[model samples]
Target: MTETSPASALLEVTDLAVGFRTMDGQVQAVRNAGFSLGAGQTLAIVGESGSGKSTTAMAVIGLLPGNGKVTAGSIRFDGQELVGLAESKMRAIRGRSIGLVPQDPMSNLNPVTKIGTQVAETLLVHGMATSKDVDRKVVEVLTAAGLPDAAERAKQYPHEFSGGMRQRALIAIGLACRPRLLIADEPTSALDVTVQRTILDQIGRMTDELGTSVLLITHDLGLAAERAAELVVMHRGEVVETGPARQLLEDPQHPYTQSLVRAAPSVAAVRLSPGAFAAPASQRLHLAETEPGSGGAGPGGSAVAVATAAGPDGVPPEPAEQNYAKTPNIVELKDLSKVYRIRGKAGDFHAVRNVSLEIPRGRTVAIVGESGSGKTTTARMLLKLITPTSGSITFDGVDVASLEKKALRSFRQRVQPIFQDPYSSLDPMFTIERILEEPLKTYKRGDRAERAARVRELMEQVALPASMLRRYPAELSGGQRQRVAIARALALNPELIVCDEPVSALDVLVQAQILKLLGDLQRDLGLSYLFISHDLAVVRLISDYVCVMKDGELVEAATSEEVFQNPRHPYTRKLLASIPGNELNIDGELAS
Candidate 1:
């Protein structure tokens, strides 16, 4: 274990003010952000998007984007000031004394190079290893980063690896030089909960073994509370709260922190009804005991299934799904399967295997799993993006697989898709109005004036300002972009919408708002959603039914209540177990 004491300040940042010169003007991205990390201590800077959590990290490392400059502040790393350090000196310290594991591995790494080569480059850049032994050291670090078959995996490119494996590769590179301090910026945000635990555990073990200090920047309060010792809550470029993680979580003084705690699905109280009260503490069951078909009774001792809901900071109780008992099936899949043949001598890959599911009209059915679990593939097939090798799909009793061009186009208007990454999904060159209007134009729903009217209507529906209609996708935040995507999906008034990880990329607050918006929209529009995501907690929030997938097969399928109360499959159980802060409740009590 590493020694972490208040007496030893490994990193001391004081009154840090950072700004960026944009087309609009100087935007103060980080203002008066100050925190101290004791030697071997883990400090988390938690905030929503545009809250300057990442800007502070970038300022410390001298890696701020173009036009970004430190306006005021003192960044002292090991008693040495680094605020005005030259590029050469900063480069020497970077990766040598301070390593960085960025948010997205795909963007951070070279796509054409092999994983081993990337790790070797880090070691070589910092002179950590000689040319003769770099290859061997690469494998060692990759293995230490928790990549299986490190020797062989090192030779493969990032494209060959899964999202988790690629992140592990980035971890290998980040820890290759064994730096004194590591800055992990949302390192596991894009990953599933199980893979997230593995990656975080690997970092913990490495940091402990090397006695390295960690600066964790993330939007996940639950993750920060569990992993970090000290927490600094930032909002609108200012630090709102800074103290012991447990203390802040249990008795938050700041309103923002309190809202964060309430919004967090892991710790939020289960809202039994719109204004329902929770059951007594005596009636609540432990996390381990709440499995599928566990017969966990609710407030009146009825057999009502329960789920977590948004309410005051209290113990999460089991809330029941919304009443959709009379709704008919909008989509039905029977024995759906998809197979693809590799170019090499290897056998075919079964992306989806004998999966059968139903999405009732005006109900949400969520598919939850890790990457390559065939969740997205199933959604793609449902959207008719790809033809499945076998099985049948019926959209409102019509065989979707047998649809011709005109009929397929008509089917598309009734069923739309909201992708995972809104930044990439929306066209960059087009204005928000154009982007939303394109769908109506393609479907030829109305004239230009009518389309513009619909665009304004969509803005109102998604709660975006009408002034934003002229703004481009680049100007919008992650949450805003997703809202635009949702608006575009709704432009056709589609009955069934395929939401693929729609809220996964957003911050917790934005995520909560988006979930609320979806729920509200579902109630108002009677919209049925085929929701696909890796986040089970979010699934439990908005989904009526839950389907757990693994290795291209449906491991478990049940009502969200049944799955949460009594998960039957081992894979489902593992996924539930892997939820961040699963062991800790809102009251900071550890599950016995």
Candidate 2:
């Protein structure tokens, strides 16, 4: 490795190794990881979960959990070695010199504390300001972080803030001290595209203005490519590739990097082959040949097959044509609106507004928007969890609003839900078999032996080992938990599935698996989906038609292709543009 001068680099990590002492044994988390961030420069470490990206960052900041420790390597900051630093000394440098914007705002921020108090506490602890100037400083930082009504917002508790607002508050605290270096770990991974862009842009402006170096750790290759000057790709605890961001992405020298580029839904121009992320070579080749213009030869050895496919065959069919092609709508919403009247608030809060949509048989209609866009509220209304103030919802020409208790229960069996956080969604006390069988038993789908057999069948359908049926939720990985959730949703063989941010919590590779599973199941079982998500990229991969929501209203609606390729609404266009790594072409070529 070439030596980087101390004067030029703000933080330099060399041959870093980290490990966790589990009950089984010492598990190495990071092995031989190295990177350098120059003053005022941005460096990003990109990888899937357990690739040691976050572990490396935490080691650099001396914030590893109890079981974790830096087993080897050197972390040098501003010519000072951090590996052997005393806890007292490390604490002094932590917030004062190196700040952090953690991944989850809800977990990072104290629920009991006011936003202003939280910001002020950081400043006071670091001795950055006196009590007299702390309030003013807090307001200034909050405003700088792009929070509206900074002073009033600061007084509100964390629960009062929206997801975006809470993130802004976290940013305010991170930048309040104007630290020389900032470590942002998956900061916008959970956010909607527009809000993510806003927060990241704000961070960029603040860091640039303050001349602070940034170390960004994320699973989003596009985000890293767009935001960072340098990129380090990690896999299985090792740095497999590191170089200039654009060059590395455009022409990755490593196999893992290549797979990541191909698997990332944001970079894919079309819906992927089922299990394409993990497909065998022959399978990939078959899919490529079958897909028009995937280097498939046509008459006269011309690529004309590709060009022809781009027209009538490839373009999204017109709505009228679509209605003609598919079966009659399985579910329909007409002039749907939901309003909540707050006791003290002057005006009623409109949670959903005159939104009209349709879910045709065996099709997926995705609702895309930022948090608070009424996507969940709209789904809840459809599920009859809450009553809609006006308009109507119909399933097979029967009004769902008028369904009685028994009929409603029957309707629920036909339309099931899969929640966002799989860990929380599944009952921890139950084994996987019991979890899957409970839904079957509750609906009286079968007797004891039949239900047990059905549980085994469900496990097979989700591609999980039957042996895992005896395991509890806590014993399984995030992906496995989600598979269990999928099995439970499929227990009744629901025709319509309401999937709400189903894969958001899993790692990228696991996310690909779950998405492929969903796509495959849809094809085989003829399932209809009302999918809701903030990730436009994932939406691109899964949905047939897309509804773009903003401020509880539908701002744009079209086929996925139309919405992605030629969005008429400015908000839709902005959301598309804001997708991380959307700037990077799939082949690592320059953006169009």
On TM-score, the leading prediction is 1
Q: What is the C-alpha lDDT of each candidate?
A: 0.81, 0.80
Over the full model, what C-alpha lDDT does candidate 1 score relative to the true structure?
A: 0.81
Flag regions of model 2 displaced more than 4 Å: 1-7, 272-325, 342-344
TM per candidate comes to: 0.88, 0.87
List candidate 1 segments past 4 Å from native. 1-7, 149-152, 267-326, 583-592
Our tally of clashes for model 2 stands at 2
